[model samples]
Target chain A: MTIQTLNPAQRTIRTVKPMPLARNRFERMAWIFMRFSGLILVFLSLSHFWLQHLIVGTHQLQFGQTVARWGAAGAPVTIENVFWRLYYVAIIALAMLHGLNGFRQVAYDYLNNRGVYRGVMIAATGVIAVVSLMGLVALLGGATIVK
Target chain B: MLNGLVTTVREGARYKGESNQWMWIAHRISGLGVLLFLVTHISGMSFSYFNPKVHEALIEIYKTPLFSVGELFLAACLVFHAINGTRIALLELKPEWWSEQHKATRASLLITFVLGAPTLVIMAWKSLSFYLATGR
Candidate 1:
């Protein structure tokens, strides 16, 4: 394996420059996802906050009220209804994806033990998935209060 | 984790901190805080399907003075995380400009505080009014 005694294939390898450590493609995608999702969420989430908390004021927040705004129990599929429904769905989807991925990133960062990290990641993914599913189900049409 | 945080802070107290170092710490802390809130919020709201009563009560609690303060903190965390994240993303996109990160971190933080101050006043008005009326 000495360079002076290199075979043709070995000499070819030697002639080429050393490559940089391979980047994890999944991680690179995740990094890109985080930035773009974050940029989008800034607008989505802020408007959501302004609408729900600031304008409506948490004082007036109620299940019936939300059901109404969420459309149907509130109103028919008018433009306003469609707008709010779409808005809610967008925020829910993006925020959940962004938040859970962020949680995973931190878990990878601080949890050095492979077994522990795996357990944590599995549990987190399952829990977040189930909860988010329930949210989407309700948003689509699961239950709206009679009131 | 709390112990680790305490240890890191204690150890780092020996040296003068760099702005980016402090900014990174703030970013992690705020991100984690928002993540926790997101979990609670989605989980709670998801109950609106199966248990509208529970959803009502949970959402109601947020209107209380105590919860208003917590909401303020959550909002602050969200705003800062969003703004600082923009800074990080910008720097990452232009690696050559990382040389200007110290300035970026300062500017980001100043923006966070500027945004946060008005937000605090506006939100705190709700909290103060609720407390004044109910003494809660």
Candidate 2:
């Protein structure tokens, strides 16, 4: 006895749908950036921790120590000072961006309403931009370096 | 209820080669861990702009033995998350490297181990010494 197969016309022919590309390229870039910046931040922040907390000890993290290392005043504008400033800039920028993107992801997941989502995104961006600018100013401003 | 819990736990214990899923979970956890640290750090660092005396006091409090131990845990999470994240970013962004994703993952793990072992030792040494000295 031979088995009978279904007719081609009666058989189901399903087309596989392609995965949807992310709607917001900026958000996609931010997602990719969170991972990239996070990797760099781990090295940066951990080394900073080692130097500030472990090596020098947190008790020694006074204004004088910070100013001497990072402050632009009194300290000559030497290569080391410039390097330290750049380093702070990198840390501040990376941490702020990465953390903000992570917050954006959380907001998207939790806030389903479109208006609320838009508001959250705007608020997060504003906060991150303002804080990052303030941080840069505080870090680079020579005024904190008391003579 | 107990049976259901046991069944769920047993199912979770089995790994069927879903590397991406595991990486995603670890990335989320590590991201959150770093964010938690960031919140405290940002607030603390801001104090530098304000009253220096209060900043110094806060720093002194953090110098306690407990925080040293916490730092070790944070370091571990940060190291793993960072390494794995780098691997994912490279694989996703660089189409040429997609074929070598497995190799890249292994390499990332090796790098994480190499970097993390020293950090773990350093943190352990610091914590132990602090605890021994403080007897707290």
Candidate 3:
């Protein structure tokens, strides 16, 4: 014999409860990424600044100097050592994504209209992508090692 | 008008009792500051591709003692933001660790100081020596 539970009117109540609505998974992931990338950027960017400016002396830092540091032998090959180029590329990519997300958050806070919010997000994405591409190209083009 | 202003100020000052609210606010501010710096930095660095001479000139301007001091402040902001951000990430990703968040915050602060203090001191020493030698 099964015992049934019912609310005052004598109708049996269902045991299973409705599931909660799906959460914004992507937004949650982006939020997590921001925190993780931010921590890493702190170390990467600070060290980059110290090495490039404080240690080498900012006055002495020039395009040619940066090219050499990236391991280019002067022409054609661009990135002689893949590791250094990759290191810089990673920093650029992470920074762009993290900053763009922050920009989106600011927009979400201020913009009430959905259309305007969407527009801001699109613009932010475009800017981040274009700028990151430009940075990569500059790093590669400037460091091209001609053999 | 004066009453309204006072009310507004009082409302703003009221504490909501979230232990991590101050840290969250600082993280947001520093994150925005870093973003602002990135805009200028990327734009200036991009000049290297268009005109090397202009890029070199920009680098020279940035080398000024005044900018060096600014860089130190930027470093402090980034350091605090990053360490606190790490704590937030850990708490959010590992739900089981939520109970220890206050401890995490303290740890993050300690770590930031440990790393940031030396970096600041070294940067200050270098900046001072450079300005003194150049007399700029």
Q: Where does model 3 exceed 4 Å of error? A: A1-25, A39-43, A57-62, A71-80, A113-123, A143-147, B1-12
* TM-score of chain A for the candidates in order shown: 0.76, 0.74, 0.70
lDDT of 1 by residue, B29-121 (tens): 898898788778877877777677788778767777677878899889988998899998889989999878788888988998997778778
Off by over 4 Å in 1: A1-23, A73-75, B1-11, B14-17
Tens digits of per-residue lDDT, candidate 1, A100-119, equal 88888777666767888889
Model 3: colliding residue pairs: A75-A145, A75-A146, A78-A144, A78-A145
TM-score, cand. 1 vs. native: 0.83
What is residue A53's positional error in candidate 3, in angstroms? 4.1
In terms of docking quality, model 1 is: acceptable
Better of 1 and 3 by lDDT: 1
TM-score to true structure, per model? 0.83, 0.72, 0.76
lDDT of 2 at A76: 57
What iRMS does model 2 reach? 6.0
**Best candidate, TM-score:** 1
- Residue-level error in angstroms, candidate 1, position A21: 10
**Full ranking by DockQ:** 1, 3, 2
Output the lDDT of residue A75, model 3. Answer: 51
Better of 2 and 3 by lDDT: 3
For model 3, report DockQ: 0.31
lDDT of each: 0.77, 0.70, 0.74
